[model samples]
Target chain A: MQFLLAFVIGGIICAIGQLFIDLTRSSVTPAHVLVGYVTAGAILSALGLYQPLVNIAGAGATIPLSGFGHSLAQGAIKAVQTRGLLGAFAGGAEATAAGIVAAVVFGYAAAVLFNPRS
Target chain B: MTQSQGQGNLQQQKMQQELQQEYKQLVKNVKPRPPVLKNTILAFLVGGAICLIGQLILWFLKKEGLGDKEAAAATAAIMIFLGALLTGLGIYDVIGKYGGAGSMVPITGFANSIVAPAMEFKREGFVFGVGARLFTVAGPVLVYGFLVSTVVGLIYYLIR
Candidate 1:
């Protein structure tokens, strides 16, 4: 049952992305869609709308790019509570530091191992 | 004169019909019919699998007594790590080719985006090549993502 929920939710997100491809005749790249999702997620998270979905769907909700936006909002909120206005500037990066750092580190490792054009 | 006009109309209609058929043939030749069913099913399964792994990681972290927020953050980081590692090993592209959107929608996909570009640009020189191009795909995402989040934070701070 839980698996079904996750599958359905995650699949819907991907299907929406596929829809963009079809509708735009492939002109709009996937990166743009992902960026749009992230921005929407950030807005929804700030409005306190996305947490309920996350609560219900678990990774189904959070595994998408939107979830990254939600985390950024959450981090900023926490930071604002503790550090005041400066958190606005610093909070998102701090919150996502682990993921960001991991990407660079692991990305560097991969670059070393693989030929680019292959 | 009336008979000549009718003939001209008939000729015009025939030419229009032929043109329509020619247009259809051109479209058919230029655009390949996508394997819609296969792509959809692969996307569904692979996307679900990635989330399932994420849920398991979340479960284990929570079981270890981390707070919900902490566990969720850790899970995301770990998944990103896995995605980047797979991308580096040249495996994620294969999965991506087969899985289509299934592999690209997850947070791991974001990691793959970052790693793929870095690898592509590495030969140009590390600083200008790898570092500069590292964010080709991810830069737009992070830029708009962070900018929107900051604006939202400002609004929330002011309103609350």
Candidate 2:
């Protein structure tokens, strides 16, 4: 069931991205991606909805930018309460480390498998 | 004869205007952006495959009695290392070329962005070596990501 959820959620997110590609002529995607994630996280957090989504989707919810935001926000909040301001700043990165690290490694493999042409 | 010549001149001007309008429409409607349908399908499949592989890797590690965090971190390390290795091997460049944002939209592209520049600059110097340059492109992304997340978190924290 969880796996199904992951599959569905993950697929949906990608599909949405495709829609953006199809609809928008905007070449400026990175900014949009980053902003979209943070906004999603903020809204979900406000509703107290993201935590449940995380429970359901795992990386499907997380591997995207919004997931990164949730992790960071959750971490920062936790750290600030326990360790103070310094903790707030550093905690977010640690929380999102898994996804960030995963991205790099997978990306490197792809790079190795196929050489890019200029 | 004068009336006939005027009609011919007017007809030519109208056709020219029509041609210009069509050119403008083509530029407006169809762009050079990567094909959305294809990229979405590819990203979903490839990204899902990567995650599935990760879960399997993590399960095996956990079965060995490693804690969840340890197992998860080990898997993440493997993924990050693989991504970095490919960036070095120049294989990822090909994926980026073919996949466009399809490959990049996933974590892999971010990894490549962070690592590729560093590898290129490895020969520059040690202090300002490949390691330093590693974050060049990716740093801004991380910064943006980090700040956004922090602010969101704060908002969440303050409210709830």
By TM-score, the best candidate is: 1
> Which pairs, if any, clash in model 1?
none
For model 2 the local lDDT of residue A7 reads 55
Q: Candidate 2 lDDT, tens digit per residue, B1-160?
A: 6999999999999999999999989987875766667777766765555455545555588789998557655765665666567666768777655444444544445566766765565567534755466566566667766876577556645664
Complex DockQ, candidate 1: 0.53
DockQ of 2: 0.30
Candidate 1 wrong stretches, greater than 4 Å: A1-3, B1-30
Could you give the interface RMSD of each candidate, to one decimal? Answer: 2.0, 4.4
DockQ of each: 0.53, 0.30
lDDT per residue for candidate 2 within A1-118, as digits (tens), equals: 6555655565566556556655776674644554555556645653568878766765556544455566667777777777766666777887777666665545434433443334
Give the least accurate 10-residue stretch of model 1 chain B, judged by summed lDDT.
B151-160
lDDT by residue for model 1 (A24-114), tens: 5656776886797788788889889998988887888899888889888877877777877888767888888887777777777777677
Q: Model 1's CAPRI class?
A: medium
**Where in model 2 is the C-alpha error above 4 Å?**
A1-5, A29-47, A84-86, A96-118, B1-23, B29-34, B97-102, B123-132
